[model samples]
Target: MKKLFIAAILFVSSSCIKVIDPESNYITGDQLASSADALAGMVRAIPVRLVNYQNDDAGIEQCSYHGMLSMLEMMTTDMVVSGYGGFNTTSAYTYGNLSARGSNRGIYPFYMYYGYIKAVNDVIGLIDSETDDTTLKHYLGIAKAYRALFYMQVGAIYEYKAPTDSRYTEYYVAPEHDLTELTVPIVTETTTGLDVKNNPRATFDTLYEFILSDLKNAETLLADYTPSSKVYPSLAVVYGLYARAYMEMASHKNATENYMQALNYAQLAITTSGCSFLTEDQWLDPKTGFNDMTSQNSWMLACSISEGNTDGQGGGFHHTMLFGTETTYSSYGWRVGRSLNRKTYEAISDNDFRKLSWLGPDFFATETHYDDEAGKWAYTLRSADDTYVGNYRLTSDPQWLRNRITVANGFLAMPWIYPGIKFRCYAGNYTSRYPGCATDLPIMRVEEMHFIKAEAQYHLKQEEEARSTLKEIMNHRITDSSYTCIASGENLLDEIMLQKRVEFWGEGINFFDAKRLGLGVDRGWQGIGYSRYQGTYDIDGIAFFWTIPFPTAEEDGNPALQGYNNPYMYNTAMFTYQSNAALSQYYGIPPSYGN
Candidate 1:
């Protein structure tokens, strides 16, 4: 597979450079359909290129999907940036003073996704003109599916144009403003270079209509195609994408029909894909937890790493977010950016298996057994007969706790008490050379379908049905089956959102969910002291949110888009933080928070 990918890149690079086509030089619409091998390589390169887009000549940071996700996850209230010693981009975004003319937070995704869109359009254009073969349409379908997915992502970040009738205010602009007007351009195979140069943002209704049309075509074309890898978009993936889009659309209306559409498509994805939710044991596996191929069975779509792919060495997701990789990669290491909010951590039920995804407050007594498969030492409490209970325990033995917790190399630092390990590097094996990890990133999972279905049912006012659906997923995840949800009214949605925050913790959908639902987040009283943003903000208000701006560079290049930037405002004072004596005892105060 590595050799094949290298050959594909060689083919793409070695060809004569085309001034007209910037993304690919070797392939034209006419030449693309000539050979099966060439066509396959071209299709294969789409995902390879998508995942490999790390940085550019500008001071842009990691722009890969995983990188973008890590950035977005850190912005949410569920996460706390424990330190600011790493990327300045993380620090800039955490401060939430992003300007339309300057911020890389909004700018990098545009660069990344537009590059991908152009590649997909090249393939789609070839197929549209030359091929009638069902096999060829499979590639076309895959391209369209990917295009829809990218458009959805761009729209979610920049501006989500709601249905014209929506009563929801356009987030962060003004009270009366709504998202009826779109801020993103709708690019397709038919869009020429000239069209791109003169592109104007379309209406929200127009963009979504085109997205749905593309998805509908993709679904029909890929109906008989079985994907070769979990990373590839298959029929099931198309259904899942459709369900996700509809769920976002449902937020615009008070009707049950859109919710029903979301529910139905989610059901199709679950049943057609034949995927199952991860068991508690599977989720807690130290060797291959949420970040590797062991969980691929539940993933409808994922990103696969191969030898030909770039390691994204200094700017990759794991390099910046996971501290355990510090032993291997010193230059790209960070130990404090991925801490969990203490309040959100406490909200989780003790019996829930997801709590194991992060480090707990309790310190263990001693260094214990090394599992051969894990290739890492884990502290475990044992019975009198030396029968092991589990991988974790609470210990008040100060001598033992102090010795183990305060190890050299900054291991288990106080502020990193809830170090998030959900998206860490795989144990025992390195996917690439040192500093470059090969852990696969899942894009969509089977458990998300259940959450979508439950949310849809809740919106439709099917309270009992929604409760049962939520319980179905909860029963599989927790050790105590007797635990029941008592949330009603708005609390029901709160419960659903909490489950999502837990399930997808580091996988990266929390901020987007908060954006779509117009939810406010409090970065906890304890957490406000740790965040560079100072405190939480209403996601739809003027203070802080994950909303991106159309960069000034883009505005300067495109004459049609001048003066089109969104409103910008900042809070006058930092949020007040009431000190907690117990928290102060657990973690000592730093010199300065925003430092």
Candidate 2:
């Protein structure tokens, strides 16, 4: 998918500026409101490029065999369309990279939130700068909420390992927003250029204190105001944000309570937003088929490419899912959607939606939406700077033939191209190419909310209620509960986590949920893994946290003294092994997660 449309107007300043001149530039009240909105949108945007693998106690999971993207590929490969280029790698590296930088990943935050901090601070300035409180409190509330959110993401993914105990320490802090700089840190306070380094890191206490303050303030601001749009952070998202913050603190008592608070807010969001769980009939709708038309269920979503969402790069209907098929884009350049391991592959029920895969005799033009916009997916001749122009064809590579031909569905192209089951947005003609037309990316949905509620209740031993909730999701999602497993006792938690993992594969919930619950990723065994929209993958090893790239390279040779780039390395001999369990053929994983 083309994610380049989030609308950050990047212009090279004559030189980086530090020490704000109130006259030269300062965020205003209106800017504060606008930036608050942008902050929400950017939060959703940050994760698209990265995946978290923490498991709290749930087993951790991740894919690190591939090299870091932003650090290397952006400087090297023109492999964006392949879904394995700089963007993916950059976002994927956000956790570690930002941590090393003493900040959040990518320029996304700096680019999106500096303006935010400015906006909020400006709002505060506006309140005191002016007379009546009026809406200033409201906007202030929003600004604070957004501030807490960005900090939470930065804190959880970047902070030094948990104190091993939550005794507040410097490690727990999120980088402080140079509020005067707003979200943009003044060069004086920030490391600029590549090698400068020397920016201050916020202590864990500082980060949490700020987050708590914001959420508490936001709760008051939101007390009476009922937002007309669910897209905005209704009270629910605030609670969700609070739960997220508490979890980062490892304050289970608080975290669990906040999670429940989140659920309440989620429920409110549904009522106010008109969102609902995916019904059996609407689970995989074709066009604007799914009930994705902003409802209470939509905690977050990138607007459809058709609807003008610039959130992802070249919206490609999430083509990275299907491996071994022409329809799946994993075959493009970067080798994503690599085949699933035997264990995970075997764990999938033949009846499960992900196991199915297909290709046609040749690619076609059936996909009208993507191709029409695709300059080429539409088959327009290359005007001039055509990289593959006259250089490749549907028949040019046998890998093409192998990738294109499928044994199922008469091996015929739909309309004219291939389509994956879960991700219905087609990538258009195999002969011609363009970014695929996937749906507005989902941030959260009733289905997952259902699972969260189910799991949370289960942990509290709301056994029967949890079981009932779990069944509601399965039956509502599939038409039959038989498709799901309902093991109690030792495996109950595993059962709940697996349901969530398979249900929300590429949507970005897995790693965090797994971490919070202390569930173990099935490097093998039943929870191994599967894919439909993303393609198959055997669990290589259970990685709980993203080994974010050490942006030492980006930070080196700079006056800012930005980061000490940490290489992506894990010593395997130290990993624990399930001595009695069998390991799958998929390589790189050690027997178990270890200290």
Candidate 3:
């Protein structure tokens, strides 16, 4: 799973330089440009630093990016945290206990992405001064693309966009704030330490402009560059990143023009990369699912997991989310990982292959059963693949026994099981205390392009075109050609959103999408079960709760962030209810609760 291993080298400079980020140091521009090898090493350092999210401060409990995704996923109605008693579990955020000073929550990602930005800026400085070589220009492109991605992610959380956010009215900073009004602090390669330390946050428009500028530069530079691996930014990822960036900016600017551009760039990424949709079999393949990076033609970019990979603070996706153990790593216990809400699980058509990502009543009743002979389920429900079907014996401390029993009892009462088998563990293949949780984490893929294009087309009032595009994605996942999405009754936009929710599920885009579209999350009803994951799924009463709170630590340190944090809104009561009636309507039958 590990790709491009490079030993860390320190580049120290005595020369004075401006620092733009708090974590950046005195590595001078001259020192960075002095050696091409040094610059390349620094470039290599970008991804190396990016993958590590472990903080000894938080007991190495979370990886910044993955943990951010975990919080977002858990807070949404679709994904649920099943592990009730795990240390520093996401349950607090899932139940709407997010605080301005929450430990290992927003602070970790804020520092993580900014730290990445600082490293990227260092590379950009070197590239700007010393790089005329075509290869170096490609590295420049990579740096810029990554910078744009970080900005987009950070901006998505902090900045309030009026078009998408209903609580924009409550924001102290104006959505129409000019270039001088700070939204996110702008730190570039040219930014000096003094300037960075005292820099004011840029306005919403200014932040978007800065992000788009980086993407534009990257797109131009990477156009002809053939990428060595999917882990690095290819020309395709550049385009895809542009498409994603434009989609976010589209609402603020020329909606029609930006949507068209978003669609165009997405198309370019697909056509230029020769990436195709995963076949039905690949979709159903338990061994691969969403985890296998190389085999899926749709994968445009992924994070690699290597042997002895401690990049995730010794916790890979398996530790944070995977429910059952394949290898020796502690699993918290089966039925105690993340889970898709039963209402959301039931919305997918029975024939659709993606439906199998989560286990439902059908899986328990027909496809799998308790192996009385082995005193375990015939297969580890960790993945859908029959090859992965085997007993999961506890080789570690069985202290998790009581909790495991509790989860097992809850599983029987719930309609569907979650923390879906989408991410499979490398059990039989490798084993060590921290054996590579070697599942490749996906960043961008071609399947997303189809969804983005459909959403843009729909927004443009090209309903039929949107339906056609939706059908293109649906046709690949469903065997029935007779299926057609209608523009009536349930509405085409909702149907498209539903498909997106189903497609992206645990991938973490649903939360952002739900917020952008001004859609309130409704997890139907808290089930009869007593599990945390099965509770009432709603965070309604909190206005703008979707906007992540600015870490109090950040505000105290940076004078620029004072009074600019998104206001915290508590859930005094559940906001709205999305009934199973719509889900039943989609499947054309009332979903069975259980046996």
Instruction: Give residue 579's error in model 3 in angstroms.
Output: 20
Question: Candidate 1 vs candidate 3: which has greater lDDT?
Answer: 1
- lDDT digits (tens) for residues 472-522 of candidate 1: 989887757975987777789889888888898767677778777765555
Query: What lDDT does model 1 reach?
Result: 0.61
Q: Which has the higher lDDT value, candidate number 2 or candidate number 3?
A: 3
Model 2 per-residue lDDT tens digits across residues 510-556:
54554344343232222221211111111222232332332343344
CA lDDT for candidate 3: 0.60
Off by over 4 Å in 3: 1-27, 55-64, 82-88, 102-104, 161-182, 311-313, 316-328, 332-335, 365-415, 427-436, 488-490, 524-530, 533-543, 571-595
Q: Put down candidate 3 lDDT per residue, 1-595, tens digits, no spaces.
A: 1111121235222011122343343345565566778777777666655445444443334353544665666666676544343432555555555567747354555666776787787677666534568987888999999999888877776665432334333432332223222356778877765775566667767888888888888988887888777778898898888888878878567899989999898888888778988887665554555556776788887766554454442543333334432333554424354677666776788778777666554433224444667543332333232232222222222233222423344433333444365555543232343443555667787889889998888878888889999999899888786568877333888888888888877666777676656666564453412144323444333224566656776677676666666655544333232333322222212235431
Overlapping backbone residue pairs in candidate 3 total 15
After the best TM-score superposition of candidate 1, give how far the Cα of residue 306 lies from its true spot, in angstroms: 2.0
Q: Candidate 2: where are CA atoms >4 Å away?
A: 1-142, 162-206, 222-231, 246-274, 289-335, 338-402, 405-421, 426-439, 481-486, 518-550, 553-568, 571-595
Tell me each candidate's RMSD, in Å, in order.
8.2, 13.7, 8.0
Ranked candidates (TM-score, high to low): 1, 3, 2
